[model samples]
Target: MLEIIGVGVALIIAVFLVLAARQPDVCHIARSIFVAAPPERVFPLVDDLRAMNEWNPFAKQPSVRNVYSGPERGVGAADDFSGDAGSGSGRIEIVESIEPAKVALALRMDRPMKCSNRVEFTIAPQNGGSLVTWDMKGRQPFIGKLFSLVMKPEKMVGGAFERGLADLKTLVETAREEAAQ
Candidate 1:
């Protein structure tokens, strides 16, 4: 009976390894939200890494420590973060900033794992508001592919992206309302 159980577990492990090996070497995940404010109003919030704390779900964690460097709102800006187990440690730098239209970042994560990725935010006018899309893409090594098989990067990170966008929407709209008062 014990032997049979061992064989069953081994089979399951083999199947998982096979699936992981079959996964793509590259992965991409994107999520978007429509903020009730114009692109001009929403652009600065994302362009400034320090201001990102106002809307980034991960930045809100009590255990996370964030450090900002370089210019406040454009290329050369960067942020380094270290936090609890759930938060990990990473550095994000703005490599491209297109003012009210797009911002692109290079992200390097260490601690829980070492990986590099690119993130971008594009803001476009739509229906009197702004449509903001957040995208992340990266190269997945064998280890990363295996981890994705278990964690499913899209569902894991994509959920965070969705929440961040919601927070951004609320932050922009609330600020706009307050300014009008």
Candidate 2:
């Protein structure tokens, strides 16, 4: 009986390993929102690393500590942040920046998962407002692949991205209205 049970457990583990290995090497997810504000008003929020703190929904934890480095805005701009286990620690650097159009970021996540990802935000003029899209692409680690088998990474992270975009829309639109007065 014991031998049979051991063999069953081994089989399960082997299957999990195989599934993880079969998982895709690259992971990409994107979310977009329409903000009732122009590109000029939306560009600085993402271009200036420090200004990001105002609407960055992910690192809102009270324990998160952030240290900025390199240029304050545009390419080479970066920030390193550390916090509780959930928030973890990571570094984000702007690798590409085009005024009122796009900003690409290099993200290195160290604690929860050790991986490097390319994050980009693109802005497009639409109906007198701006359409902003956030995209994150990375190679999947073995551990991440294993976890992916249980829960998809896209679904897990999509909610945060959606909420962040919504928050950003509200913030910019509200400010635009107030400024018009």
Candidate 3:
């Protein structure tokens, strides 16, 4: 009876670990919104950390809070966020900028489960509109890899990214439309 109980407990733990290891190698989420205005106008709304609260999907939710630091509207700007277990806390810094051409940021976050990830956002001009891509890349720790056997990372986070992007597209485009009129 004792042997059976130990084996049962071990099997449960193994199942949980396997599930966590199968996450994605590169988790990417992007959405393009064509503003009647120029990239210069639309990009500013996204490039600024403080400005994001106005349209960010997470910002709309009550569980999250964002604090800004560093510069005001350009490179070196940073924002720290904390929320529910899933939301946790993280900081983002503007890493690169080329005026209306491109802007990029580095994202580092500490999630609830004690997992961490690195993320980046790249914005580029395309046909008078802007193409904004949100990407996250990180390696699973040894234990995380083992967990992946049961859970695929991409599958786990990809849906959230997709929804977030869709919401962003709507927010930016609507704001731009309002400004134009």
**What's the TM for model 2?**
0.95
lDDT by candidate, in order shown: 0.93, 0.90, 0.66
* Alpha-carbon shift of residue 135 in model 3 (angstroms): 0.9
Which is the better candidate, 1 or 3, if ranked by lDDT? 1
Candidate 1 residue-wise lDDT at 164: 98
Model 3, 35-139: lDDT tens digits are 444567666766777776666655556888888888887788888888886566777778876776566777676775445455555566777776766666665
| RMSD to native, candidate 3 | 3.6
TM-score computed on alpha carbons, candidate 1: 0.94
On residues 4-25, what C-alpha lDDT tens digit does candidate 2 reach at each position?
A: 9999999999999998999989
Q: How close is candidate 3 to the true structure, as a TM-score?
A: 0.71
Model 1 C-alpha lDDT per residue in residues 6-107, reported as the tens digit of each score: 999999999999999999999899999999899999999989998988889888899999889999889999999999888889999999999899999999
Question: What lDDT is obtained when candidate 3 is compared to the true structure?
Answer: 0.66
RMSD of 1: 1.4
In candidate 3, position 139 carries an lDDT of 56
Query: Model 2 clash pairs?
Result: none
